[model samples]
Target: MKYEQLANDILTHIGGRENVASLTHCITRLRFQLKDDSIVDKDKVKNIDGVVSCVNKGGQFQVVIGTHVEDVYHAVCKVGKIEADSSGEPSGEKKGLISAFFDTIAGIFVPIIGALAGAGMLKAILSLATTFNWVSPESQTYTILFMVSDIAFYYMPFFLAVSAAKKFKTNTFLALIFAGMLVHPTLIGLKDAGDAVALLGIPMRMATYTSSVIPIILIVYFQSYIERFAKKITPQAVKTFLVPIITILIVAPVGLLALGPIGAFVGEYVAAFFNLLNEKASWVVPTLVGALNPLLVMTGMHYSVGAAQAVQRATVGYATIYSPGALASNMSQAAAVFAVSIKSKKKDITALASSCAATAICGITEPALYGVTLKLKRPLYATMLAGGIAGFYAGIMGVKAYSAGTSTIFTLPIYIGQDNSFIHACITAGIAIVLGFVFSYLFHKDEEAAPVEEEVPAGKTNVELNRNQSEVYAPIKGEVVALENVKDDAFSTMAMGKGIAIEPTEGIVYAPFDGKVEVLFKTKHAIGLRSNEGVELLIHIGIDTVKLEGKHFEALVSVHDTIKQGQELIRFNISEIKQAGYDCITPIIITNTGDYLDVIESDKSNVGLDNTILTAIK
Candidate 1:
């Protein structure tokens, strides 16, 4: 609900719910398949408060929302009244093969990314535990944890089946049945025993499905068309059960005989290609990933590299391609931002840069990449140079990560398997940070530092400034809630300045004092007011009601309209808003709370329209 307003803003600017054909989300982005991309208001969406950035690439309109993207994605689905679909397949126009490929891979992988990362990290933790002899491998604790981590990779086809079924728009349960067949214990036993098998006298090729990726994806894709064909051929009356039976009967043998082996070959070839490249030119992948990751991230193509690494891990049980270089790149970005934070004289820029730098070091680099490095052109170059060199060093050292997770300083435990790999990774990170900071600080310039004021002239004495106090009355009849208790972090943390929330019992909002509306949101759920007494306040009608897109609410006065205390300002239908599943908890905030010594909330639990709610003391 906290992201509803942001979702609504995005939906509105991106040509509304109708323009959205299908929607999905990854770790940090809302991937949208819009019906008409040209009509999207990119600037408006990029400027939305919660959005980190916006990208139009891989045939999708991607809204970057950092770590909380899943929340925003659900909010978007609810607000836009659109079903969240994993099939980000284009519904409007055909796209280039590369774009289509990226979209397909993203759709198939995005849904289970959390599970994949969690399991990978758990695997790494298990490796660390055993390596350090903290837990005996024969212990039940180790056995249980190992199984927990192994299930994800061991049964990867099941996970892939579900996601691919959704992406290919096939019956998910049916596809799951197919995956079940592929990894069935009997089939696994036969393959393990090296026994020959045949379907109806035709030879069936045996290939392992456990921990496999491409075979299931190809099977599910093939299932989609076969399922449709089954539906068309079977009578409607018997279609329910008969269709599945017919589709499975036909596709099963073919998949085992042809597609399964073909997919295996493809997967093997792909993995072999990367392994060969790593073998022949070990520095190439790391240097390229290090230098170009930012560009790939900006275009939302980084997922492809991640998918390749996942494949490599599945194929060979270890990978050294992506993570090492990615670590160097992330560290470089962190260092560049930290350098900017240190060199900048402006408090706001320094604060922004410092926080973004910390986030980058934690391995979520989008904040630094989009917010700081990309904005300051020189810092991006500095990071690229630093990352490339560090990555080259890492490659030369032959560092390898034994697990998968976000590349971060703390995740170096993943490099524990290979002797000295963890040490090389650390050294690479150190090099990246040092070079990035030095290059950025030397090349990038901030605004000239403010000149120091001349010491107070001895001839002049400072004059005392007078202070004034003003009262802000209740804008609506409600049970008052302290700002700290508000659900929203922006309000409860006083990040948007001091404020008090209300659980409104009525449907109307009135002017708290004589004031003019400085700004009114298009959704009419919030307003900014400037009182005659110099108190600037913001009145938000409900939590996330902006998603209603102005429905169930009407503004009596527009922006710049002057009004007196107790005059009607906004009239909302409380019943209707509640029916639509929204909390009508209005927050009356002192936007300029810093200008006052204190903005005290009323002690009274309940307040009427005329009751004093805030006292702004200056």
Candidate 2:
């Protein structure tokens, strides 16, 4: 299937392999850890032939490639030689508050989605078995399968440790060692003893870590920093030996004695607080989550609530308000997708919107957000209003789920209880769906079709170029060179949308066309311009010239300032620049080449000033 080609294409679209710091693929997306996030051309990646979409979610830049992600992942690994799960020190600055929050929830919950799905399916099968008397609940066969199905949920901390360690860039093996200490058989035995055991002159107070969530994750994050510090300080001669010895020595005591207990205490307090809130103002919690959920989802902050769910489950064995609100919010999105599919005039948009709606109902919301709700802004508003109404009802009724899974119509049985509260919850979900459907349908407006192109009059004269009219002139007259020959791909690929490159004949650069200066980088190494004829150009002065501190160069224009053709944009002392050990090869290319049909480069071996260099055509 030419998998290598696809990988190469994807790498090119993302600004090449050098731009990537790390890469991993999950069930359906290729996640990239980029060296410079700003260099990532998301629109270019999205428009790539094989890509379904591009997303930045949960602190990871993701490219959705559907089910073939494994093939692409293999291809990427072949070229980069970096395994998807290898642990290393983090490369960039610490993530922001919201980015960190979402990363934590996504890191914790996404790994569990498969487990929850498989467990839910098994429970469904078990229900069928018991209902039809195929196997009694007491049967040995039933017991075995139940244990298999239940282990993933019952011992969730072990699974969380492995995934969280990867996310935190810590040693997974050490993290497992830490998780084992928390939930060791001996510790469980100690708990059974009721304060009977002591080790190393300190009394041991053991609590079951199985089925718990937050404590181990937080501990692992802290452990990553400690491990990284140890690695940094240890001398090269015996660093490997010294690192493990120091890391274990430092982490073991702190995790076992301090962080673990503090985390547990915090979890208990939060659980108690949530219980209090539920008892005092249950409706308020759900109402707020519901009302604000649409906004959160739009801004990609809804993962915060998922973290709250994990904490709730670890402390209280059930999540009271958040998931129910999320369920309604998701249904509202599905409704908006459906409305767009029905009302939109464009056939392609209708198909995309309908498919996105179906996908959203099944528990994935990206397609719905990227393809529908956000596309038609009014539908998003309608969904938020409807979700709030549904959340209010669910909260008043005290609806809760004992288990976590996808919040969809088919999983409604999970919310059912023998009490009237269950019935009320069901009615609330139904009304929420209906309200969303009504509001979206009423508010949605059909998009107008694009006008068809008309032919120009035969007598009309237009300036024509044989092959060079649209080609970017040498902004700085120099010997032309291919971008790939340069040291840095980021600088090399500045001409990505516009094709070709040139080694400057001289260091002084002139404005190629009469245009307004859009951006003059602070470092004086690059300039962006929009021509009066509507061409967008990026003239990067030199390879890695940003390191030169603007020496030997003087800028003549500021950003947003207008300049005429042949205007002196920047003056450079060519020999002085070369003596400073800097390459003066400059790349001049069109930044908005996508709007043109073709860009043809001139065939001339040596072109003079004002000579036709390249041409763009419709």
Candidate 3:
């Protein structure tokens, strides 16, 4: 119940769960790959209480939810009946290769990033401890702690296999077995001993795979197709055992000999190229990364950079490329947002900027980026410029992050090394913050604003419908009455459908929404309509007034005629109906109330024409 309303609202604005092709959450956002981006009500979603902001980029509809996004993600899964960790089958417009790659990368990495960060942080702390002699490296405590810290990174393929299997929608155990095969003691010993290993007479490229990233991902992707092909040929009688057997038999040799070697070569070459770039110019990559980081983040190409950085880390023990530049960029964003907080006069903007700045400083930047920097425009330029300058200094100093986690003030320990790299990283962050603040304070020009009253459309109510729901508007100006108080048993018992009775004063009925007239009584006293969204409504005028209904009532729309909201559908004389000695309390019934979870009535005792009086909740 805590997040139920928020979940429902989010699903409603995103065109319901049916429109969602897949859903995943990162550190601070719920990422949705949607089938129809056009129908999403982004403004409504952004205005939801728990939602910080909404973004559409890189084929994803992202709802920023702050640190507690996991709980909210679970809530969304529960409400939508979606399986946790289910990477749904692809459906929708075909994505470009770049978009698909980034999407795949995010899906595989997002689930494990928190654990990876924790493990990385532990390794960083151990590095700090050993460097400071707080614990001797020979101590048993140190040995165990070091082992614990290094385990996740050393056996990284095992972790990657699970996440990759989910992303590729393949068998997880098979993927795990594949990872086990790569990291098996026998294989590692073979590689260590410089022995040429052959499988089924095929010579294997004894590439080290314990800490490898690309190989397992490539293998799992290949296995997804091989597994599907295996399943098709295997007889159902032995399908369970034979399918996996066939898959492993086919996948093992091909993967080890071809895919694994190819992936390792690609990873090595990419890392080598980046190293060469750094060796020749030293500052070009860092400077460009810092300046373009925000744009990269917005396009979700940051994940691509992160993937390359992961490969670099797997190849070496530390990262000098992406993490250093990202640290500078993150700190710069924090400083720029802090400047905004100090400069803004409005209480809400100041409060928001202050909180976002704090979050950005802790290594999450989406809130600050979307809520403050990008919204203000100038702050983004300030941050990017500041980041670029800081990154150049970091590059020149040869600052390297010794671990993989968020780049933050607290994680600065990760930069600790045998050289002056740690101090240089600190100086880099300081430079970013100082330059970011000064530039933002100077460049920012607040826009003069004026309050504008919102205008409501003619013949419409402000009340909006949620998912699987619709609003029924008052057709005539009248005093609202409870349905139970009506004279009719069918309505009083809710047998006709859930609705409310209104005592009519004015007697013109308007169509509630775009719909078709399904029924018009010859007596002209009752009308039945179905909305475009499938809300079936019956508007009955006066109790048993059918005795003299045709005498005072006139139907403007005929049966089966299409009508629009606010279009006149009926006209009646209230005085004549009263003079005829009949109760003129008109009841609007949702004849298909069973189709909804609940039908709720507006609390107002009196309603004006076109005002919302009933809301059907799905």
lDDT of 3: 0.84
Evaluated against the true structure, the overall lDDT of model 2 is 0.71
Quote the positional error of residue 514 for candidate 2 in Å.
23
What are the Cα lDDT values of the candidates? 0.83, 0.71, 0.84
True-structure RMSD for candidate 1: 16.1
**Candidate 3 lDDT tens digits, 1-618:** 799999999999999999988787653468788999999999899889988677786577888775467689899999998777534321222459978888898778777778778988998898889888899989999899979888888898999999999989899999999999889998889899997889889888989887889999999999999999988988889998999999899888888899999989988987788778778877887787778889888767787788788888888667877888888899999999999889878888899999999999999998998788987889999999999999899888888877888888889988886788789999999999999999998888778856545455575444432344688888778899999999755467565678999998888888977888887766678788898789988888887665562778878987666688889998999999999888899888887888999999989989986688988888
For all predicted structures, in order, the TM-scores are 0.61, 0.64, 0.62
- CA-only RMSD, every prediction: 16.1, 11.9, 16.8
lDDT by residue (1-618, candidate 1, tens digit) is: 788899899999999999988897653468788999999999898789977677786577878665456689889989989886735422322459989888788888878878987887998898889988999999999999989988888898899999999888899998998889888999889888987888899887888778888888888999999999998998989999999998899888878888888877887888899888878888888888888889888766778777777778888877777898999899999999999999988788799999999999999898888777887778999999999999998888878888777888878888878578889989999999999999999978875636545334455432211135688999999899998888655467665668798899888999999878886665678788889779999888876565566778788896666688999998999999999998888888887888899888899999998799998988
Q: Could you give candidate 2's per-residue lDDT for residues 34-101 as a string of tens digits?
A: 87778788888877877767777445677866445668888877876666543422222245887777
After superposition, candidate 2 runs with Cα above 4 Å error = 1-90, 124-136, 196-198, 229-242, 417-422, 449-618
User: Rank order by TM-score, top first?
Assistant: 2, 3, 1
Candidate 1's displacement at residue 72, Å, is 15
Q: After best superposition, candidate 2 residue 33: deviation in angstroms? A: 21
